[model samples]
Target chain A: MTRAFNFSAGPATLPESVLRQAQAEMLEWNGAGASIVEMSHRGPEFMAVAAQAEADLRTLMSIPDDYAVMFLAGGATTQQALLALNFAAPGQTCDYVVNGHWGKTAIKQVGHYVNPHVAASSEAGGFHDIPARSSWQLSPDAAFVHITANETIHGVEFRDTPDVGNVPLFADFSSSIASEPIDVSRYGLIYAGAQKNLGPVGVSVVIVRRDLLERAGQPRADIFNYRSHVARDSMLNTPPTWNWYLAGLMFQWMLAQGGVQEFARRNATKAALVYDAIDTSSGFYRNEVVPAVRSRMNIPFFLPDDTLTARFVSESKAAGLLALKGHKAVGGIRASLYNAMPVEGAQALVAFMRDFQQRNG
Target chain B: MTRAFNFSAGPATLPESVLRQAQAEMLEWNGAGASIVEMSHRGPEFMAVAAQAEADLRTLMSIPDDYAVMFLAGGATTQQALLALNFAAPGQTCDYVVNGHWGKTAIKQVGHYVNPHVAASSEAGGFHDIPARSSWQLSPDAAFVHITANETIHGVEFRDTPDVGNVPLFADFSSSIASEPIDVSRYGLIYAGAQKNLGPVGVSVVIVRRDLLERAGQPRADIFNYRSHVARDSMLNTPPTWNWYLAGLMFQWMLAQGGVQEFARRNATKAALVYDAIDTSSGFYRNEVVPAVRSRMNIPFFLPDDTLTARFVSESKAAGLLALKGHKAVGGIRASLYNAMPVEGAQALVAFMRDFQQRNG
Candidate 1:
C-alpha cells in the first residue's frame, strides 16, 4: 500500500522502510525470543541496542570525543526547564536569543529558574529573520546563551552556530538536528526532541560537553542534573526503551541512506522545490520569512485571501497531503519536510500548490 | 510457535496475545492508513486512543470523578522526585515507608525536593518483611506519605493499604497495579510505571485527587506538575504516544480477561503454585519473607545450599524458563508473576524447581 505523506511538525512522519522493519521485528527481535519492548533495560540485549544507537548517532553527527550523548525523556519543553536547572543555578542569569515562537516559549519556561536576558530578538521584525550577531547584548556573567536553531512554527533558521565567547552555547535543534551537517564542537549543548527528524516521541537526545556537566553541582536539582544522567549513562532511571530502540533503528536507516551528507542534499532539493512553487505564485501563495533565514525543514506560506486558508488545507488533505494546517499562532499553511519526507512528496505538494494557485487566482 | 516463559522484573513480560495483536496492526490500525505510532497525537484517532486508555484504567481501578488519570513519561523514578515537588514543598516533610530497594531509591531521590522522613523501614529486617504498621511514626503535619505497594526486588508487599489518617497517601504500584483490584478513594495519589503489568517502559500512569493537585500551585515545577498534566489531559507535552496506545491495548486485554477481580484470582493461583513448592521443599528451597506479608506478585526464594544458584538459573534457561536470576542487590531467585504471566508459566517454574531439588538435594 502506498503511504500518504505526513507533514506534522512533530510526532511527525517516519520512514516507511523503518516502520516495516519495526513491524517485522515487533514480536521477536533477532531470535531473542522477546520483543525489544519486553527486554529489560539492564539486560545485555538492550545494552547492545543502546550502545549501538549512541555510536551510530555519534558517527552521523561527527560528534566530538569530548561530548557525551544522553537519551532522556520529556520533550523539548522539558528540556527548556532542564537547561535552566543544569546550566543556570539560582540567582544566575542566561542570555537568550528570541527569533520566533519557540524562542519566546523557551524564555517564558526558563524564566522560572534564572533571569533570561534577551540578547537579541527578531520579534520587532515579525519573526521573519534572525537578529544580527553584532546586535546581541550578551551578559558577561551569564551561565550560557540559548537559541532555537530552527523555529518550526515561523519557518526560520540560523545558518551558522553563534559564538558566545566564554559562555557556553546551547541550541534546541528540535526540528533541524539531522537535516544537515553540523559542527558539534561549537555548542556546549545540543538537544533535540525525537519527534521530528529523529524517530518517535517520548525520547530526547542531548549532546553535552564534559566541562559544562560540572555546572550541574547544584545541591537540590533532581532529574535535570546532567551529571547524574551522565554518570549512570542515561539509565539513572528506566528509560523509554521502545523509543530508544526505534531511534536506534532510525540511526541505522539514516546510515543506510548515505548518512548526513546525502540527507543534506535531499533536504535542500525538497525545500527548493516547495520554495520555487511559492516564489512563482507571486502574491498568490506568499511565504513571509526572508530568504536568508527561511528554514529548509519547515516552510510556512499563506494565500492572499484569508478565507482560502481552510479551503487550501481541506483540498490538500483530499490530495493525500496531511497535517498541512499551519500552527494556530501562525495562520495559513505549513509544510514540514523532515528527513523522512521523500522528495517526491515535496514535488507532489508543489504541484498541488501550483494547480491550486492557477484555479484560485 | 510456543513462546518462552519470561520473568524479567520490568520491561519484563507481556501477554503474547497483546504482541500478536500489535504485530497484526503495526502498519495500518483498523484501516487507518497510518500506524498508531505514526499518527499525530493531537489527531482524532490518537485522541480516541488516549481517552479510551484513561477510561479503561478508570474502570479497572474504580477511580472517582474527582480523581484525574494522567499518562505521563518518565518512569517511577521520575515520579519519586515529582511527588516531592508536587506535594512536599520546601521546608515541608514527607514520610517514606521503605520496604525494599525501590522504596529506598525513592527516598534518596525525593531527598532532593523535601526532607524525606523515614517513617518506617524494613531494611533492618534484611528487606524480607513489611514493617509493622503499629511501629510507624506517623507525622501529623506531614505533606504526604509515600509507600511502594509492591517491591519488585525484595519481593515484599503491603498486603493491605495503610491508614495514614488525613495525610494524603501516595503509592508506587509499579509491579502490582493491574494484578488486583485497588480502592482508589483511599489514596490521594497513585502512580505506576508502565513496564510491569501496564504496557512498556516509556509511559507512567498517574492518578491524582483534585484537592491534592491544588497543592501544586508552585511557579516552576515543569512537567512534574500534576495540575499541569491533568489540565492538559496528559497532553501538556507530546506524551509517549505509542506506549500509551500499547497500554490501552493491555487494558482492553485485561478487561476481556475479566478485569482486576479475575486477575486477582489468577494471580493468587500463580503465586500459590510457586510458594507451595517452596513450602513443601523440605529444606531444599526456602522463601524468607513472613507468610502474612509475602508478595503475591513477586516470589523471591533461595536454595538451601548457595552453591547451586548458578546451576539453577542455567538449567531453568535450558528448560525454556528465562530471567529467573534475582536482583543484584538481593542475591537469590525472584519469580515476578505480573498479570501477563499465566498460571501455566508459574506451574512450569514450580515443576522446574521440584526437579532441581530432587536432583541436586
Candidate 2:
C-alpha cells in the first residue's frame, strides 16, 4: 500500500515531503545528536526549532505583533473550555453562533463557566447552511462572539467574517485555517488543532490579542491561563516537542509552497473539481450545503442509501482514495480537501466518483 | 553527528530500538496507507495502537483491572491541575508532601481549586532529601495525599510509599514511572508524562483507581472531566495520535526487554556508576542528595565552580555525550538515568568524568 489520497478530515494527510524530512531526522536532528522528540523544550537545539516555527507561522499567516501565538498540547476542545476560563468572567454572557457540530461542541465545553447564548444556529436546518449574519441575536454584554469558521462535520463555512460590533470575535478554524488567507487582526482569538490543515494531532496553535490576556476571567490554575503559556513562550511545562517539531516542518513546507495565497488558489481548484462531480452526478449524489457557503475544506455529500455509502468508503480505500466516510453525526460521505491535498488528488477522487456512479447508478 | 547519549530530563532519552522502529514506520505505519500522525484518532488503526499500548502498559506495571488507564495531553502540570479538579471539592483540603521543585510545582497548580496544605517539605534543605514519612503532618479530612514519586530536578525520590490513613494516595511519577516494579493498587492515582521513561513528550499515562471516578470533585468543563475521558477511552477528543503510537512501540520494546524488573536492575547499575564517580571525587565533585532517597533516575551533581561545570558541558557534548547541561532551576551537571539509557551510556559518561577530572583536578 503506497501513500494514498487521504481525505480522513484530520489527522488527515500531511505533505509527503514533510513526512520524509521528519523520517530522515528521526534518529538525530541536525547535529543535536538526538531526535527532536528526546530533547528538552528549553534546550538550545529545540529552542531554535520552536523559534523558527513561530517565526515561520507568523510569516505564513501574516500574524501581527499585537497578537500572541501559542503552541499548546490539549487541542481545540481544551481551548474551547479555556476560552471561557481565560477571557470571560464567571457566568458572563458568551454569544455562540452555532453553525454546525463543532460550534455546538464549542458551546458545550463552556456551559459550566459561561452564560452561553445561542445567537444563531443552522441545526434547525440540519446544519447544512451557515445562519445569516442578520439572523443573529447577540448579547450586548457578551464576553466574545464565537463561531466555527469551517465546520468539518457539517461541511458548512462562513465565507465572510461576521461583524459583531464591540465584543471580541473568536473562531475555531481547525479545518479551514491556512487553507486560504484571512484578516487575522479582525478576530480577538483564533485556534486550530494542528491535525487538519496544519501538521499533526496532540498540539494546537492559539493566536490571541495580547491585551485580552489581562482579563482575570475566572479562578483557575496557572497551567490553564493563556498568559502564563504565552509568557513562557509556550514552554510553560514540557511541550509536546515532537508534535511541535512536526508542525514546524509543516509550516516550513507551507511557506516554501508560497504561503496561504498559494494554498487558497490550490484549495479553490480542488474544491471545484469534487463539487463539480457531485453537482453533475444528478440523482446519484447530492450535497445539502448551499453552494455559496459550502466548505472548500470539507465537502459532505450523500449517495442514495446506506449500502452505497459503505460501499463508497471501502471502494475508495481500495482505489487509493481514503477516508471518504462522513462523520457519524451526519452519515454519508465527506471528502475533506485540506491545504495538503494536492489538486491531482482531488481530480483522482472526482474520476473515482464518476466511475462509481456509472457502475452503481 | 550520529545519535549520542541524550540525558537531559523529561523529553530525555528513548531506547534506540524504539527510535529505529519509529524511524522505519514514520512515513506509513503497518500498511495503514498513511502515517500514524495523519490518521483519525478514532480510526481502526490508531484505536488498535492506543489499545495495545494500554494493554502493554498494564502488563508492564502490573496494574489491576480495578484501575482505569488514560493517555492524555498537557503533560504533568495540567494533570497536576486536573488532579485537584477531579478528586477534591472546591476549597477542600489536600495534603501535599513537597520534596523538591516538582513537588512545589504540584502544589502551585491546585491553589485556586483546593486548600493545599504542605504536610511536609524538604525545600529548606535545598531539596537534597525527601521529607521523613513519620514527620509529615497528615491532614485529618484531606481528600487525597499528593507526592512526587521522584523529583527530576532535585534528584530526590521517595524510596517507599507512605501510609496515609483513609485518604487516597496520588503520585506524580513523571520521571521514574515504569523504571521499576511497583504496587499500583497502593496509589489511588499515578501519572507520568511520556517524555521521560515512557516514550514521547506529548502524551501522558494516567492510572487511577476506578472508584475515584465516581467522586463529584468540582465544577469544570467536560474536557477537564477524567470520567468523560475514561468513558471514551481517552478519545474524548483527537488525542496526539503519533505520540500515542510511538508510546505503544516503546511499551512493546520495554516488554520484549523483560519488562520493569529488567530495567530496574539496569537502572540501579547506571545510577551506581555515576553516583560512585561523584562520591569518590574527593570534594572536586559532589551530589548533595541524601543517599537513601537519591533518585536512581536523575542524578544532579556540581563541580567546585562555574568554570569547570561550563567546560564539562561543552567538552561532554564534543565527546559525543549530548544534553549534559543541568536544568536552569538547579545549575551544575545532571545525568538522568532513565529506563531507556543503557548501562553502556552510563559507563561512557563515567569514563568521560574520570578523564575530565584527571585533567581539571
Candidate 3:
C-alpha cells in the first residue's frame, strides 16, 4: 500500500523505499539468517552497519575527522542536560541562545545541571526569528555556546551557523540536521534526534570534536557518559539495534538521492511551493515566522481568522493532508516537509491550500 | 524468509509472527495509511496502540490498576539509574541483591545516584546460585530492595520473590518478564528491557506503583524523570515509537499464547530439556547453578574439559546454532531461551549437546 504523507513533528515520515528495504530484511538481514535487530552489537555484521552509518553521515555533513560520531539514546532533550553535564562544571556557566521552543527547552534542561547564561533570546519577538549573533553576550570562560538550528514548533531556522569566536559551538539540530549543507568545523558538537530526518525515535546522533570528548567531565553512568559512548564506539550497552539498522538504511537512501546537495535543492523546491501558496493567498493565509528565518522543513501558518483553524485541520484531514495542526503553543497550521515528503505530497498540499484560500477568501 | 533461532543474550530473537505482522504493516497500519512508527504519539491512532499495549500487558501480568506502566528508553541499565535517582536521594541507601553480571551492573549504576547496600550477594559462590533470603543483610531505612529475577549470563534466577516487609521491592525482569506468572502486588516496581521476553532493545517497560511516582525526588531532566514519563504516558518525549509498537505486538502475542501460565509451561519444558541433557551427561556437560535457583530463561553451562569450548562454539555454528558463545566474563556456553524462542530451538540445542556428549564422553 502507498503510504500517506505524515507531517508529524516526530515519529515522522520515512522514505517508502527505506521502509520497503527494512521490511524485506526484517527477518533475515543480508542473508545472515538473523535480523539486524537480533545481531549482537559487538558482532562484525552490526559493527559494519554502525561504521557505515557514521561514514555516510560524515560524508554527507562533511564532518571533520577530528570529530567522533556517537549514536545515543534519550533524544536531543537528554543531550540538553548532557551538554551541561559534560562541559559545564557546577561552578561554571554556559551560553544558551534561545530562539524557540526547542532552545527554551534546552535552556531549562541545562539549568538543571549547570548555571546557563541566556546570551540572546528571540522570545521578546515571539521566537519568530533568530536573535542576531551580534546581540549575544559571550562569557569568556563559558564552557560552550548552545543553539537549536531549527525550531519545529515555531517554523524558524538559522540560515547560517553562529560565529562563537573561541568557545565551542554546540547545536541541537534535531529538526534540521540533514536538511542542507553544514560546515562541520564551525561547531564543537552537533546532535540530532533520529525521528525527523534520520529514521526512528529511539536513537540520537552526537558528533563531538575529539578534544572536547575528554572534557566530558567526571565519570557518569554508562548511558549518560559521552566519553564512554565514544570510547566503546556507541556500543557501551545494547543499542537500539533495530533503530540503528533503520537509520543505516536511511543513510543509504539519502545517499541514493544524490546525497545532501540534491536533498537541499529538492527541499528548497518543496518549501517554496508551499510558501508560494501561503504568500499569494494575500489576507487568507499568513505564516508567522520571519521570511528570512522561515524553516524549509516546517511551515507554520495561520488563517486570517481563528474560527477557520479547526475547519482547516478537519478539512485537511479529509483531504489526506495529515498532522497539519500547529503546535498547541503556536496555534495555526503546520506542514512539516521533512526528507521523506515527496515533491508531489508538497504539491498536493500547496494545491489544496490554494483551493481552500480561494473558496474561503 | 524465516528468521534464525537467534540466541543473543539481549536484543535477542523476536517472535516471527510479530515480525511478520509488523512487516505487513510497515507502511500502512490498520487503515491509517501510515506506519505505526510514523504516527504522532499524541494522535488518536497511536494513542490507541499505546493504550492497548499497556492494557494488554496489565492483563497478561495481572498488574494492578494503581500501577503506572511506562514505555521508556535506554533499556534496563537506564532503569537502574532511574530507580536510584527516583527512589533514593543522594545520602540515602537502597538494598541490592547481586547474583550475576546484570545484578552487578545494576549495583554499579545505582552507585551513581545512591549508596546501594549490598544486602545479599552470590559473587562469593561464583554467581552460580541465588543468595538465600535468610542470609540477606537488610537496612531498616533502605528506600527499596532491588533484585534481578533472572541472571541471563550466569543462569541464576530467584525462584521466589523476596519478602521486604514494608519496604518496596523492585526487580529487573529484563530476561524473564513475561516468561512466567509474576506476583505484581508484591513489588513496587517491575522493569524490563524489550530485547528478551519483550520485543526489541530500545524500549523498556517500567511498571511502578502510582504512590511511588512522586518518589522521583526532584524534577530532573525530562528523560530521567519517571514522574514526567508517567504524567505524559511515556510520550514525554518522542518515545522509541517502533520499539514500543513492537513491544505492544509482543504483549498481544503473549495474551494470544494464553498469557504467562502457558509461557511458564513452555519455558519450563524447554529449560528442563536442556538441563536434563546436562544433568545426565555424566561428567561431560556441567551446569553450575543449583537446581532450585536455575534460570528457566538462560541455561549457562560448561564442558568438563575447557579445551573443547572453542570446538563447541565452532561446531554448534556449523549446525546453525549461533550466538551460543557465552559471555566473556563466564567462559562457557549460554543458551538464552527467551519467550520468543520456540521449544524446538531448545530441543535442538539439547539434541546437539547429547550428540556431542555421546561422541566425546
Clashing pairs in 3: none
> Higher lDDT: candidate 1 or 2?
2
Model 2, C-alpha of B184: deviation from truth (Å)? 0.3
- Which candidate number maximizes TM-score? 2
| Cα lDDT of model 2 by residue, A116-206, tens digit | 9999998889988888899999999999999999999989888998899989999999998888899999999999999999978889999
lDDT of each residue in B2-56, candidate 2, tens digit only: 8898887879888878888888887888887888889988789888899999999
What is the Cα root-mean-square deviation between model 3 and the actual structure? 1.5
Task: List pairs with backbone clashes in candidate 2.
Answer: none
Residue A109 error, candidate 2, Å: 1.0
* After superposition, candidate 2 runs with Cα above 4 Å error: none
The digit string of per-residue lDDT tens for model 3 on B165-274 reads: 98899999999997898789899999988888886779889999999887746435666788888889998888887888888898999899888999999999999999
Using DockQ as the measure, the top candidate is 2
Task: Provide the TM-score, chain A, model 3.
Answer: 0.97
True contacts kept of 2: 0.86
List iRMS (one decimal) for every candidate. Answer: 1.9, 1.1, 1.9
| Residues B14-75 of candidate 1: C-alpha lDDT, one tens digit per residue | 88888888887777677666677877788888999999999999898889999989898888
Q: How many angstroms is residue B287 displaced in model 1 relative to the true structure, after the best TM-score fit?
A: 1.6
